[model samples]
Target: MHPLPAILIDGLRATLFRHPRVSATTVGAGMFVAVVVVYLFASILLEMAGTSPPWMLLPGGVLTVLGDSMLTLIAAWLLAVLAARREAVWGIATVLLAATVAAAVVVHWPLGELASYLVLHEHAGLAILVELVARCWWFFVLLVFAHWLAPRGLGHALGSAVLAYAVSAAAWWWLPQSPLVRTMPVVQATAEPTSGDQDGDAKTATEQDEADDDDAPGAKSEFDAEAAMYAQPALLDAALARLKPQTPGKVDLYVVAFAGDAQQDVFRNEAEYVETLFAQRFGAAGRTVVLENNAATVTTRPLASWTNLQRTLATIARTMDPAEDVLLLYFTTHGSDDHQLLVDLDPLPLNQIGPDDIADALKTTPAMRWKVIVVNACYSGGFVDALRDDSTMVMTSARADRTSFGCGADSDITYFGKAFLAEALNRTTSLREAFDLARTSVDAWETADQKDAKPDAKGVAGVEPIQHSEPQIATSASIEAKLAAWRRTLHESAAVPFAPAGEAMSRGASPSPDASTRSGKG
Candidate 1:
């Protein structure tokens, strides 16, 4: 056998509690170089072995191995201190380094893949069992290594092994998020037409999406934002053109829903839900325009922007009798402490909307008389002052000085979006009543989250906890009466059930709205 292979075989045997001929004096700086080479090979292999193809390789994956190496060195030093053998630290480090790599390749990738496959196949119970077994086996490997190296006792060796595993895990979990170290490459794969479709008659997935109905919630397709940005004007025009011309003498309702933050899918989900909810339940079919800043909808829906909002408001004013039709303006996104809506989609230069801009836009469009603007964002109460008027009703998610919860990648909808748009609005037509119910629901959720929140290591001892976001509302008697008259015109109907984009779009079985959203966390 080759010398390197022979050394690795001994190291693997040592991890399994088998004795080897390896000596403490023979382990030296050469072992460190071997460890580095092995780690690089293993990480590169793991990177290419993801469930999804075209996986981006993170170069800073080396940081993980470096962290593990340092932790192993520390553990060996601690064990040497306990055994009163300063000279034996290098030997212990050498063996433990090789054992850790063996554990990584044996336990992490192979067993982890089995557990993930079980999970993907909907065998979550089996997956959990496999994960538990994998963890036990990994710990056993480390414990065996420590027991052989520490002369003091099993107790001291156990502590050293625990420290090694804990520090290694912390490094693995947190280092990926470090912007300074990780340089992730974007993997874009190009595929040529196959022999069966050499004539180019087959449609690409994107072309198929465009050929399908945009109203279908399940017809989501991804596109390059920067390249497709020029299509925004035409997309907006097409959406507006689909609207049924306003019938004379009927108290019509026109909806302009804006989801301004593309970073969180929660905003996009909320916007999609609102579009379906208004069209199906609120008697606004062919009269709603949804502007979203999401990656999935960039090609299908008009990108949410300051310019688009102006065009939409102007077009709606021209379509409806400004004095008679009711307009509901819905805005969902992150807010700055200074009160600006975060309008963004990467590589697209979009401007953020402020309270003054909103007020000014509506102010210039003199024909939009009865207005109800809903702002679902942190620190949105600041908009109330600028938006309040006799003909406009302003509803905000949080106080000017406070923050709102439930807006992130994990959440399907914001706390306010779920309570107001999904639950309360479904049950009641009265805006005031819906706001009241939603406020109660939001308060309950925020309170529960507060109690469950754990103070992390970085938390200051005396710092005050985040307070409850008090949802604010400014109503107009005139607009309420107009809305009430429109409510009287609607045919009596059952409450529309809420669903997120995936589930709701799947069956297409409901007589009601099909956009379904998940619960909690923005």
Candidate 2:
């Protein structure tokens, strides 16, 4: 085995636990040397991860580490003075140094690097949570070792443990960051080069290639992300401005369509198609705004972030009368087990919207007294409990514990999205009637697919049925009447056609127009 790993393993076996194996013997110079070495190694791990947009070593970082070392030594000295009458001072110091060395090698190795990997993905919040848990473990280790080093039979070990936590606190605040390193600020000077700056573009491209090779994955495409983020404010403002004012005395229906999870184009396709459906069939022309998290729409349509959703909802509320206007929010995304709508556009820290976010956004406006929220994602029925109210109609793609299908790289729309928006809503504006139709269609489609599904390559099982995704709906009596009234105002129109996003709109461009007016297009 390599000497470095061999030594690390030895340290872990001896001093990594609550009761360290090392004796309260003399504090050797070599023990202190080992402590310093392990600390420097841990610092290297933190600083290296920090620098990949990644953190870089700040000036005086070593000074902070040195100060931490000094605190541990000073703490040991104080405990020795109070307990051992200076007789076992070196022994106490030895135990502290041994504990420090073992803790560093263990806690910051697999654990520290894991946290840093999340940081590379722009998930610093998760890293901080990890660091907090690490801090707690660090304190526990210190407390146990302090009990071993304190004077025997004196019962002063508890106080010694408390003092040991001071050392832990000093280590905690400065460990991940330290006098050490900080994340690099994103710069806005990375826009694409103009025709006149071709030579500059070439140079920049070469520089980017070097950076890509040298730094971690987090470093690459950072500039592109910065430019994209810099352009969002304008894109969001434009989307908000496009919302037309409410027609007088009519129960105006405004739509906010959100497409999350940029990895799959199915979500974006479903959102865009629904936008066309509501505008052409439902007479909500000029009263809809789309927010999608797609690589293509980053600069055109506002990214579907919780903050953007709130802003869009607030603007829509103000545009229409609070007493009678109805808002329809369509969400198409991949859901997690815990029911969070995945709001992801890589290298951009977009906030994930959970069930509670819906109610919070509505409360802020308090304008859309009537609403129909359709969530077309797996496990989306979990949102019904959080969002359902007397004046609101909530519909979900699947039960809280079930999974919905038809959303993937090859899919143009999810099963629930197609049935609810592309089929049901296209045929009838009554949300209640549409949900019933879509539900039946979804159940039949799922049942037929399960029967036709082939077995695994091993072919161990015969044809059997799969569990169904029981779609859920929460209807409001008041909202139903308002929707019925609004439907009366909608112009006579043909059922909107069902076309995949790719067929309906070209990538990186908005849909040309509502082509659903033609008869029998559905």
Best by lDDT: 1
Alpha-carbon lDDT of model 1:
0.66
Give the TM-scores of the predictions, in the order they appear.
Answer: 0.54, 0.55
TM-score, structure 2 vs. true: 0.55
Runs in model 2 lying further than 4 Å from the true structure: 1-223, 462-465, 506-522
Write down the lDDT of every candidate, Cα atoms only. 0.66, 0.65
TM-score of 1: 0.54
Residue 489 C-alpha lDDT in model 1: 79
- Put down candidate 1 lDDT per residue, 109-223, tens digits, no spaces: 5666676456434455676677566555645555666666665578877886676555443333333221111112121122233222211112222222233344433224456
- Which consecutive 10 residues in model 1 have the weakest lDDT in total? 513-522
RMSD of 1: 25.3
lDDT of 2 by residue, 161-197 (tens): 6665665454444342222543332222233432211
Query: Which regions of candidate 1 are displaced past 4 Å?
Result: 1-222, 364-366, 455-464, 509-522
Residue clash pairs of candidate 2: 50-54, 50-55, 51-54, 51-55
